[model samples]
Target chain A: MTSESDRSRRDVLILGAATALVGAGLAGPAAAELKTVVYNNSGGASADAARAAWGGLMRDRASSNLLVTAPASVARLKAMIQARNVEWDVAELVSQEHKQAIRESMLQKLDLSVIDLSHTPDDCKDEYSVVYALYSTAMAYSSKIAAAKRPGSWAEFWDVAKFPGRRALRNHPVDNLEFALLADGVPKDKIYPIDFDRAFASLDRIKKHIAVWWRDGSQPAQMLIDGEVDFTSGWHGRFFALAQKGETGFGVQWNQAMLKRSWVGVPQGAKNPREAMQLISFMIDPTASAKYAEGIGYICCDARANNHLPENVRPWVMSNPAIAELTVSANEQWWLDNGELAQRKWNDWIVT
Target chain B: MVRRWFWIPGLGFLVLFFLLPVGAFLLQSVLDPGPTFMHFERLFEGRAFWVSLGNTFRISITVTLICAVIGFLIALRIATLQRPYANALLVLIVMTVWISLLVRNYAWMVLLGREGIISTSLVALGIFERKTSLLFNEAAVVLGMVHVLIPYMIIPTYAAVQAIDPALLRACDSLGARPAQVFSRVLLPLSLPGLATGCLLVFTLSLGFYVTPAILGGRGQTTLTMLMEIEVNEQLNWGFAAAHAAVLIAITAVLFFAYRSKFGMDRLWGQEL
Candidate 1:
């Protein structure tokens, strides 16, 4: 035990000496910069876009000290928060996650005072989260079945007689349940207190038609490419990515689509909470948000950002007003209250 | 004495990497933040658990049976062949084993999908008026598992069949026993040890298979692994996931012991197995 204590003391002495050496080795006093890490699940192109926007903004700011880092998974972010080693100053969370995180007291409350909100959408700014990305879970159909018309709404999507072929749905219960409920003739406004029995009954009606229940965003898209099924529910951004490569083999309709927002939150026990708040403030800036949307094919509700976008890409990034009006916005607070019951019902319904 | 020092590092690695994580996860099965069995009770009550457990066992048994028949034949061929042919056959079996399971499953998917080569050809031949897809179904899952597991069956059967003395077969021939009699009486009993080992290996693997069933199987065809994944990733219920996994592990262990005694594979296979 004495030897162990002595060894630790020697190690501490060495660490202190190393720190002193590093302090002495500096060429000059460095500028005071707040280094903040951002946890993001969108790793490939979206992360690059986030980094690019922040890199320029950080370079120009004299007193504005900020650094952003993006980690990949919510499970990892949850671990960091639980351990109180929250390296993420700001994190991108899905709507359900944002709601759950807030309920769990995992996030620090957002102070809107630090942010410029003159051009921000009222829906985007919130007490606990700021909308980072907006995408749609919409309908898509294969063009291979030449006789079948494109499904424009949930009702039409469910009209197997008119659009006859095998169908696909995501493995998750969230959007699919909503769509099924909608097809069962539940009004969009009343979707909140979901009539559980009716919703599941509606799901059962079309269960046999569904040939593939995909796990990831990419799976539905891959299924379309693979011709695994004739029609499916899909994300618009993924379809847009495919459409950009000339003529897409499948088509998507924005009618009755569900719009989901990804939000950024700072953990309550972040390693650098102040730095994280600064990064969050920067993220809401119209210019930065616009650039991110442009690169990632997602919508950010900075009105200024939408106005500044390249004309060709703007329509794709922000849902056209006509298209946007047709879709229902997910009520995350409702989900927070009802998720457990809904998840249980979903599991039992699927098994049955 | 030298091995004792080596064992310290080896045992340390096992305890740190394997035992610690497993122990922690197993503890999570019973002990939640509030110290309750809520998660396990929830899992047991859910129909998904029972359905997927049944499906997992059903697939494992089916795959094991198919593997035994096909692998036994292949191993018999290899054992009876000349040296060069036997070497080539062994290399082929190893090659199949070496290929990635994901790659093999994807290949099967391509063959079975709507616009896949098979479907296209069938359509062209007027075998069907429209393209028929078989991508996500129980059949595809079983076919993929069988293809992947054949090598497991083959290796053991080959080793077991090879162990039977040539002189035994010669003695049977001298006694005017037919080839069929020799195969049933002499060869089949001698190779039973290997067949038993291979079936168990394939069966255990199919029970735990996640990726194959997830990619290939459709609704009502999902397995225990998929259910466990849904619990962990979608529901974020690690406790329930752990309990389900523990149940699967326990079941597999029980089966292993039962099979070991019934077939005497415990003696025939190596100690590590």
Candidate 2:
């Protein structure tokens, strides 16, 4: 027992020394003791884009620092909220989730006094969150096959006979319900508080032709590249990236795109709330947001950033004026309130 | 000099790694957000869980049946071959087992898709007027599941076949017993245990499948795991998700109990009946 306890103590000592060495390597006289804030967002390509944008710029300011992290999932966030042990200073939440956060009071109201809002739009900055990226779920089709009979809108997407082939759609009701409503001749502005009966009826028409119900943001793009299905609806960035690199032959239909904004929110009792707020303020800087948007194919609301982007990349991003005009903003609050009911209906509809 | 207390470490590992998490889930399903039956009640009251559960049973049974037939044949072929040839073929079969399930499923998606090699080739050969997709169908899901499970079926059956006495076959031939008689009376009885093992393994594994069906399954082809995921992730209905999980556990347990009652639990672990 004595030997085993001694070994554990030695192990702890070694671990402590290694950590101290790593910290010594990072620390310098010039490196001010900036309170480190873990900026939690969806990891992968978007995280890279975010790092390029706000990460370096904030670090340059030498104010409170930030470290980018992956997926602060709702479950984890809720647990932290309940326990009063907020791990992340800033969390990137989607539209409905952002609204859900506010509704649950999991997040503290942002101090707009610290964050500059002159360039950021009214809709982009709420009390709880500041919009980081506008991810558009748009109609993406096989560029090779969709040309002659391309689906210009959700209506055309459902027209299997005109452009007869298989399709992959997101399994959820979030955007698909809106697309169904739109295809059924519901106006873009009137999509929210979704007409459930009508929407499901519309979805039923094209149900037989759907070849895949894509679960991931990346799946639809690969499906298009592999020619798994002739048509699918997915995140705009994937289709944009495919087009940019000429990696896969694919086309995007921006018309009636369900554009939803992803936001960075401060947890209610974060250790570094001030730093988190300042980091969010710096993130909304027009030039940096533009760079972030260009690097990733998401759209930022700052109009000033649009002119700085290269011409070829403009058409792919939501920053493109033409593409912007084509998109319809989904109601975040409505989704927050009605998401559960919609899912229940969706579950029944999907099985049938 | 090894004591019975030596087993404590392994038991502790199982308790820590397996039992605790599953026990937490079992507890959480009932106790979380206050104890209520609404979540489990939703299963019978709603069409989603029933449909998903139905699909799970159908897909698992079908895959198990196909694996049983093909796996037994392959084992028989390998057993009848020369020792070196049998070893080479066994190596080939085992090599496929090393490949990731996702990679295998994705390969099937590529081969069976609309503009895939088979579909395009068939169209080129004037077999069809337009390009067609073979993916996102029940057949594709079954085929993918069967492909993944066949190796599991083969190894056990081969072991059983390999253990068969060759002198018995010579005696049967000398006694003027027909080839069919020898196969039915001797080989069939010997191999039944292995075939049963393969069927149970394949069916149970196929029941829990989420990835292959998620990637390949279409609108109506959704399974219980997929439904459970949506409940957890999308709805954030932990209680409901737990209920679905409990259902899965219950089904697996029921199947296992039935098997154990018939064959005895010892056979399931290693011993052949």
Candidate 3:
């Protein structure tokens, strides 16, 4: 009887060990799979587009698996990083914010070997971050006003007497300061380490003329569409989306459009780093990239993607001499250094 | 004993959802990378932060005073009506309460915007020269808030006014007291608890309002809630955002206690305010 009891105890111990081994086996692949969490600035529409772009790559059975999720806001994602519980595997961040995140050491160094760069433009491919998408902040004016030779550049956009209608600008300091400096005759390539005093002085000149200071990409577009304002600062995609909806008598001037890049970053301490890189690689496919650009009304960073684009929209999507002059690359480092101060000063100035 | 077990699930739910989240959020305010007062110090240093703080208090006080006075009168009028009329009026007040706050705020926005009904009417009536944009001003913010908050004020006032004994009014009149005197001496005093309660409710709610201020008062107007929102949403300054939220919650608690003590509100059962 004592031998039988001893045998039962042995059996229990063996069963426990077997369960532990099976549990570890189930968890191992998920652990090995590189987990990438991406923070998308756009709402549901963009989230859907990103998922579609990544769906095929993730569907194929591979050792490295992809995981995609978007935080409700950039702030929540930043909070996670700040807390040192960096759950985000990857994030789609704005140009100005990308600089801020890098300065804070919340991001991981990009490994080119993991990312497929075959379709990436020479200018866009970089050691730190690859420019994921290109969009413009251009002057959008009413069609009625467009007939009146509406403002062609930032200087003209700020000239109340010349443009002669209610104008609106973004509420953000980053783009607004650039627009102000440009109006003050600062060259597009030299709009960095922004002359804050000069920019604010210039901004003050047209402050009263601005009936609205838009807070979102959609606002400036909506303002022009509804005739709430005659001229406003707008993103190309927003206006493009508006144009697609109907014959909205709104047209854009690309002459002095501020070109900005939206970048994707892999956060440090990601659950699945390899999968994140693979997903990032899959997202840059020229054909898939072009399809996304057309669907979303923004240009992809992949120059080869331009070939797949429609003939009519090709010029708008690709980098050319004309497009280059119209675009201004924001100095991420300058903004990183000055963003907090600029924001504080902007709030004080607006309130006063 | 059987009924006691039924409460276990509800107790668990509260512990899991409301209590746990709030406790965690409160913990985040002070106990950051390390326990520090840095967030609060930063908040106090900025003039914008101080100004917004003052604005929040000032607006909430004014709104609460206006709501209480107006809500009390309406409640009194409804309470004095004939049974059928009072019953119908009660239904209307309840319906207003039932309507979503977002829808109400939107309705008020249409009434107040530059191209909205009010501006259009004023222009047609030759009250103003050009269409004035009321879309981003202090007046617009207050107007939006009062509309959304009036129902909260009215319901509580109605209950208080309804509960006032009719015999006391008759007694005052029999003793040669004027209507005004009777109101000042008895009716108003009796309703003080309710009035204080409603004011407290409106004041606390208006303190943290976001959408009304954002849509109606767009720029050059912000409250603590808006500041917290910007920090979390745009700036991604969660430490600052958490501090702001913590301060707002603390202020709300103080206001709650102040209201309770002032009117002996703690004596009443099932009176949230």
* Number of the top DockQ candidate: 2
Against the true structure, what is each candidate's TM-score? 0.84, 0.86, 0.81
Best by lDDT: 2
Top candidate by TM-score: 2
TM-score of 1: 0.84
**1 or 3, greater by lDDT:** 1
lDDT for A84 (candidate 1)? 71
Residue A208, candidate 1: alpha-carbon lDDT: 75
Q: State the lDDT of candidate 1 residue by residue for B131-197, as single tens digits.
A: 8887777788899999987877777777667656687877998999998998899988988878898
In model 2, how well does chain A match by TM-score?
Answer: 0.86
Rank by DockQ (best first):
2, 1, 3
DockQ of 2: 0.18
Lowest lDDT sum, 10 consecutive residues, model 1 chain B, at B264-273
Off by over 4 Å in 3: A1-41, A48-72, A79-90, A99-114, A121-129, A266-278, A315-321, B1-38, B81-111, B172-178, B246-250, B265-273
lDDT of 2 by residue, B1-273 (tens): 579689899999999989997887777678778988877887778888889899889988989999999999998888788666766776677657657788999899889888789899999999978888888888989988888778778766776666676777778889999989988999888888777877888889999998888777776678999988887766778788888889899989999999888767765545534
Each candidate's number of clashing pairs is 1, 0, 8
State the TM-score of candidate 1 restricted to chain B. Answer: 0.90
Can you tell me the CAPRI class of model 3?
Answer: incorrect
lDDT of 3 by residue, B82-164 (tens): 65676577566555655666677767656665667788789999998877666767787788788778766766666566667
